[model samples]
Target: MHELWFGAFLTPTAENAHTLMRQAALAEDVGLDIIGVQDHPYQPSFLDTWTLLSVLAARTQHIRFFPDVASVPLRPPAVLARAAASLDILSGGRVELGVGSGAFWDGVAAMGGPRRTPAQAVAALAEGIEVMRALWTPGGPVAFDGEHYRLDGAAPGPFPPHRIGVWVGAYKRRMLELTGRTADGWVPSSAYAAPEELAAMSAVVDRAAADAGRDPALIRRVYNVSGRFSRLAGPGFLDGPPSLWADQLAELVHLYGMSVFVMAPTEERDLKIFAEEVAPEVRAALGREQRQAAEPGTSPSATLDESSRPRLPKRDLAELSPAQRERGMHLVRVHDGLREELAEIRKGLEQVAAGRGEVAALRSLINRLTMRQNYWTLGSFCASYCRVVTTHHTIEDERMFPALRAAQASLAPVIDRLEEEHEVIAGLLTGLDAALVAMVEDPDGIDGVRDALDALAGALLSHLEYEEQELVEPLARLDLDV
Candidate 1:
């Protein structure tokens, strides 16, 4: 698959936790695959990285979430491991643990610590990784002996439901070698090195992977294009447009065999437009080789839509009609946007009640904030929809209902039935949230979301239709608030 991982750079400082949740929900709607936050201590624009991630795990589904790079030298390795594991469990294994050697001096100063030398930082990082891995591996009493630290018979962890992939942020030779030997993936930020320079490090990583008896191919290569300038955009924008940028980036993939391209958009609107315009072409080009590799021996499935032209297997909302598409947009905004966030908060509380630690505790707070924001956003949508419904209902109540009541109340029974359906719609939201909580806590929770989605679709649509029936004619009779 040709996968382009993209995220918006957000922090608890500028947008706050609630904004992050809303943006994440929006990101999912716009077809972004991942969401990330930065870890910077002194920067007012930065938030506590782990806290944000743990909460994101509980809130989002399908989209991968992580810190761009967390400071390994600043925190205790065991604590980091436990936190990462909890996040993994909560996110259903969508957590990508991206770690780096240490903090920037300014960040270290902000945290009241002295910066380590490159050698010291690398040693600390390697030791931290060993400790983290040991803690995560299933079993009691894990041990690690390293130059910087030693652990004796430390009890093995609250293991993640799935293996938490380890990504090392590195650019220098030493870091690259170490990453190749141990990392599940490598994240080379644009701030660290140019793409061409990073490609040179890739060869060293391949060699180190061989030395470590690991599959070189298994180590995912990711480039974080955070501050990099691209020549791909409209006239007003700084970077280039998608087609031109894709052609340039494709050179990197074609020549250097890079795997993951994470475009961290400097501007909000630019990123959305970029994904909409560029993602498909990049996806198609990347998959061309893979598909060609499979084409010779495989029989392809049916490839036509109702019109008989070749159909793309997955299509985004942009492809749908305005009305049909709006419903999906509404559903995504409500479910991912708010309802699920509230559910994550509830789960965090449950975890805490059950005696879960810092990771679960902090996550709960983030989820609560995010969910409340979702509700506010949802309320806006509901208020708009309700205005129209209520205005229509008022006329029916004053005029039509009385006439019906004089004849037989049963004549307007459909209106009452429709009002009654609201309760069912409301109940489904609560039920769906519960299912999501279950999904986060257990492997079976995923099945719950699937079942709940089905129940919700029927319940919600019925409620909408019933409400419209009672109001549409009555609404036309008056200059409605809607």
Candidate 2:
């Protein structure tokens, strides 16, 4: 499967044309893959979809441009094909065609387009696909005779610079089948199709692809998602923090095979959050899952191997005294805090990377504000995190380790190993601290800080995992203070 792709779906309204263009530029700047504008040519307030896309293509350098779902009624497939190909050539293959059968009968008719039944619409779309493919092919003249469209002696030229994907915006069974059989991708909106409905819809496409002797995986699944971001989370889907969006989108990729997420944001900040926060985390989560799936004897919840080490005497939780249980709870709570802090430290590092870019034009202003605000803020947060980790380890070594060893003789070796690992982590923390200090002295030392933090993260995370695996149950069983 392809790695996840992210795009922005912006409204192509005349009133917000400038704002939309700015958002498109920002999307490219922030590393979004594509920019899609909704097509509603009949709507007086909306800009012509193709024209808007062409303009966006000219303005942005790298981002792909497409209509969210071009109305085939307003856009004849033969002409649409030529327009898409021309744009693709001009933009150096930065165009994807997202076409729909048709919608809004009254509006389409008002635009001097044919209004047909559902069956006729599907048939017309199928014929349109045929006509468009013929127009894109390198041939002398194309001749297509269908009930909906016909092209006799139509000259084909100006091929797309790349194999442009024909992603169909599909929801119905016939459209889904057509998408599986002909289209290169499937685009669906979360508003129209809920997450719970995706599995069944995907199954329809999969079966159709299989019946047509095509690999279902070859069909790229793209979802047009819209949601809210808030400091406070709600019960509804995607109405929470970026982390929740990441988790939900990752599940869609892993379970439903929806690899491309085209976010339809109402606010500008949501776009940045989607690109900077949700996208990367979803990629990371999917990467981890893929790696684990590829590895033999690996499970999602696999714990550290402790067979070689001495085993502590087993004692049921019921057998534990209330005081011992309370100690175990304390240990668990402290470990949770450490884990959360480690995550925050990593997030801070990400912020540093995101902000590390050329500021030559505003070098003076950036130096003044960044050094006084952004740099110090991150530095303080990281320093506090490091201190917390160090304190937790110190308490473990001076208090918990001795107590556990004295109570249970078999745990002595484990205590010794943990203590040794703690020393290693302490050294890593010192290195990280030095790196942060260097960053304070020289602003360009962010790279060095990143490297130091990475090293620390690897060692610290591994040590924490091993410690938790070896200590949690034993701590609960033994009469020792955490």
Model 2 pairs whose backbones collide:
none
lDDT of 2 by residue, 1-482 (tens): 34357999999889998899889989988878888888988899999998888898888776788889889878999999999988976675578899998878999999899989989999999899888888877769988889989998999855654457788999999999998888879999999998999999999998887677565665789999988998878887788999999998999987878878999888888889999999988877865764453222222222112223333434433355645544554555676577557656666665665666645575877654675467778889988888888888888888988888888778888888778777767776777777777777777777777656655654565566456546755776665545
lDDT of 1 by residue, 1-482 (tens): 11335555555565566767776776777767676666665566666787777666556555677676777766678888988877765554467788888758667767776577888888888888889999977567977778777788888766654456788888777888889888988888765667658668889898887677564655667776654345545442224657766665666666665656676655466567656766666556655643353221121111101111111112222233434433433322332333333333333333332332232564887755554444444334433433433454455456654554454444355545544554444455455556555544453344444444434443443344333323322332333232
Of the candidates shown, which would achieve the greatest lDDT relative to the real structure?
2
Q: Name the TM-score of candidate 1.
A: 0.57
Residue 323 in candidate 2 has what lDDT? 55
TM-score of each: 0.57, 0.62
Residue 235 displacement in candidate 2 (angstroms): 1.3
- lDDT (C-alpha) at residue 176 in model 2: 93
- Evaluate residue 4 in candidate 2 and report its C-alpha lDDT on the 0 to 100 scale: 56
Question: Scored by CA lDDT, what does every candidate get?
Answer: 0.58, 0.77
- Candidate 1: where is the Cα deviation over 4 Å? 1-4, 11-18, 42-45, 109-114, 226-238, 293-295, 298-482
